[model samples]
Target: MHLVPLIECAGKGFPDGFYEFKNCDSFKLLKEAREKQFVSYLNIGATWKPWHLYRSTLPFTPMSSPFHKLYGHLSDPVRIFTISGEFTGHRIPLSEDLLNARMVMEAKLHNLPEQVDRQYSSTSQSTASTTSLINIVDPETKDEVQFNDPDFRNGIVTCAALSLDGHHVALGFGSGVVELADIDHQHTISRFQLDPPNHPVWIEFVHGSHRVAAEDSEGNVTILSHDMTAANLGNLPSGPLPAVTRVSDNGLFIIRVPRNTDSSWYDSLTLVSILGDPHLQHLAPPSSNNFTPTSNPPILASEPSTSSSASIKSDAVLTIPHRRTLGFSPGAHYIGAFDGLSAFTWSTSSGELISSYRVTDFNLWIMNPAVPFTCSYRIPDPVSPRPTLSLTEGEAAHTHYSETHAGHNLDSSWIKCPFYVLLPSEEEWDELTMLDIHSSAAGRTPLFGTNGKRQRLPVSFNGKLEFIIPKEYEPVVFSGAKGLGAWYGDRVPFDPTFLYSPRSSKDGTRILLQGWQTAPIVVDLSQVI
Candidate 1:
């Protein structure tokens, strides 16, 4: 319950980046909730309006960035990135000026159906590679379609992720195209194609290797390799946000629900193991005790479910190809700080970050076993400054401005991966055995120091952070930032609430509660984890 924000914040609960956060009754009420054990949360957004009635109607979204505390909106493409150890974030120019660009594109293409069809004619991966500048003159309407659109192409971001090192980001678009963006330089690096161009619902980067794992809505996965060798992961369980998985370190076995969906985006998980065999078992989320699979983990070189993060400034992007060429980019961008996620990390006694780990569902803890055996590629640096989100927009709404930075050790293949799928009890306050990555394993040698595998501890929290049930929703939720919509109790959700997600930092001390309507919130859970 000790809340130490990674950065400072203003009086109204807004972070330092926001221009002014002088007063907010809703934020105060949320603080009261934390003290009363009703809930614990801290608002991270600047108050859009100071009206007393805005609390209940604050806007929120479902889509968020991949590991860091960044959030995005499906309709409005603006995105923000929060510093580690807190929920307060500054707007990162992910889809910064997308609103204006979208408006322009709409004006240019809205009247020209033929031109629009020709331009977007084929969602096929074979279409001439897209770029920042689109210049096509239609003969029929004698109209021209030309502009500098970010790799996002103004499409809905189906999936995204930060590289292992935290210097880059890979974004999967509804256009069936994936783009690699640079965090340090602030530009897109390259683009990957998804065959049949279905909305890539899941995407990820294989740690220490050069591979991107991407899965479309129809469940088809493309293991995109920079070496031009791509593999098809076939189909996987398909659904909305966070239906993602990671590959094992060895190459075989996809561990679905490797870690229980620890955020609000998913409800009780049903463990379905595609063991790369004739027989597969479908198990439900365990009510009590850890649930182990009856069968050994299958080869993710074959297929795997989706899950994948990064806070480091050194992060890079993931990439791929279409058809039989093979590529991979698994994800659920889950849309929340944008909810920042905690990928496993290891540090030294002096508190210098030494090693970090990525997770895969394969039976064994291979930061991503499938990464080595299967084709992998380190997505190249962001190509150009084709703004997806314009700086103009990134600076709006009293948000903070952030300079893009990168970590120095992105190329390091260092890892401490655990390959177990321990189903957890969703009942709020229930205890679960979790690996304590913060407490390092000192025996590691060869420069790994304390940045190696550590012990597992039984941890618990003091809140009712359960999945939202629409049937239990109330029209008038509480006025506080943490209260259920005008209502109270563990079940707190409504139509707009599901659009967002949440994640923790590498050490798991600060948990980011992501939302779009208002700004994100940070909760200090160091006391629990």
Candidate 2:
């Protein structure tokens, strides 16, 4: 588990004083755009100025436009910045502000929808100036395509997803309307309304296919294609709405649904297969205190069952509670889920529990189904100074002298180190020790140097097990105020600050890491990992 330092950018990169990276900022790794080497993120600064961060090998160039804020605060002003590289010559106004945006395959088409205001009054002067539009910009030519729908004009966009090939973009609106638009034609290809008109919570384009699945607040999931053809995945039990729907690159659709019990709220990870029978696998870990065993054993994919009804079958069930973090391995061989306490990985092919770990203060974990080990990184505190240098040089020396004179004192600084632990296997936890890897001099090493503390990990955890990182992986870490601090895995138990989650590319080769109050750092996973 080694980390390499890559490119790092500060908030000063933006011309305006919009320096902080807020949680609302959009950070994504483009899957289908022509700029394969670049990653995109949107920053809505404190000054109400919006800036787009497109990271590439080329030097950083400030780009801006006169666009309304996604949230549309009255104070936000329009500004202009230059778009370079593949997006050169594109002078797009931020006016078509996107609540959610995704990259699609490059295509030349016309008749893009006009921007419509969320207020939706044909006569309102204010509404005319603040209409929200979806801008599909060509990465190669910098040409811009805009789409505005009557439904979305009056409503807010809750979520969006792009197809694997990037030819289509699926948008979920606040009005429970899901629209599929063709990137080439810049028009709505298909539209479907959720029966009760519940706001769409999650939307995803199935990987390797054109089918799109969207879930509403009513716990109903509709699977559709670009042509509005519906695929019956079966009915879901009446429970809390799913947190997210993940489509593996292999085209496996998995949903993280919540089930309320007498003791606590638990999550169920349900897997729906497109090719075979609409088999559903339910995985939930047993509650901490309620050890009562159920009459039924954990279900597996290979278990023979005779139920052919349209009703979904619980093919496999685990005792662990359902987690919002759910994912499948690269080849769809395994599924993984994480809660606050632990991470569970299972074999999708055999329906066997592959590995599970009781993470100590889990911040973020990354694993490929093809890989044998799961990598977990944690930061003790984002705001605290590094423990190795927490004290001034003179103070550190004085403290060391005081401790030394007090007769064989043990330094407690190791507890403050950030963690980057590798759990080789689920069964190997007992053999691991925090003290085995701790070094009194570790803080002085290059890995824990000042620059190393600010490095960010590129991989993002989408609650899907599929990752762009390979078996032998090297992750890039950013340095400076915006960089991430990592523990050396020497500390046995520590609380983690889940500040920002990292995102990975579809092919598992690149990652986008958003730091606190800083621009996103894009790292090429192929280079180090």
Q: Count the backbone clashes (under 3 Å) in each candidate.
A: 99, 44
- Residue-by-residue lDDT tens digits, candidate 2, 1-529: 0001111222213324333433223221111111222332111111211221222212122223111122123211221111111112222111122222221111112232232222233545543333233253221112111213333222344555545444455656545667765543444566777776765656676644356776665666667665655654555654322343556555654545443222222334566555443345665443322332233232222211111111212332232232114555443444555444445444443344433455442323322223222334343332222223222322332342232223111112222221233333354335532211111111211111111122221222222211221111122221111111211001000012212222334543333222221112233323222
**Top-lDDT candidate index:** 2
Give lDDT tens digits, candidate 1, residues 316-339.
111110010111111210010001
Question: Over 4 Å off in model 1, which ranges?
Answer: 1-154, 240-242, 246-254, 258-529
TM-score of 1: 0.32
Worst 10-residue lDDT window, candidate 2: 486-495
Top candidate (TM-score): 2
Clashes of 2: 44
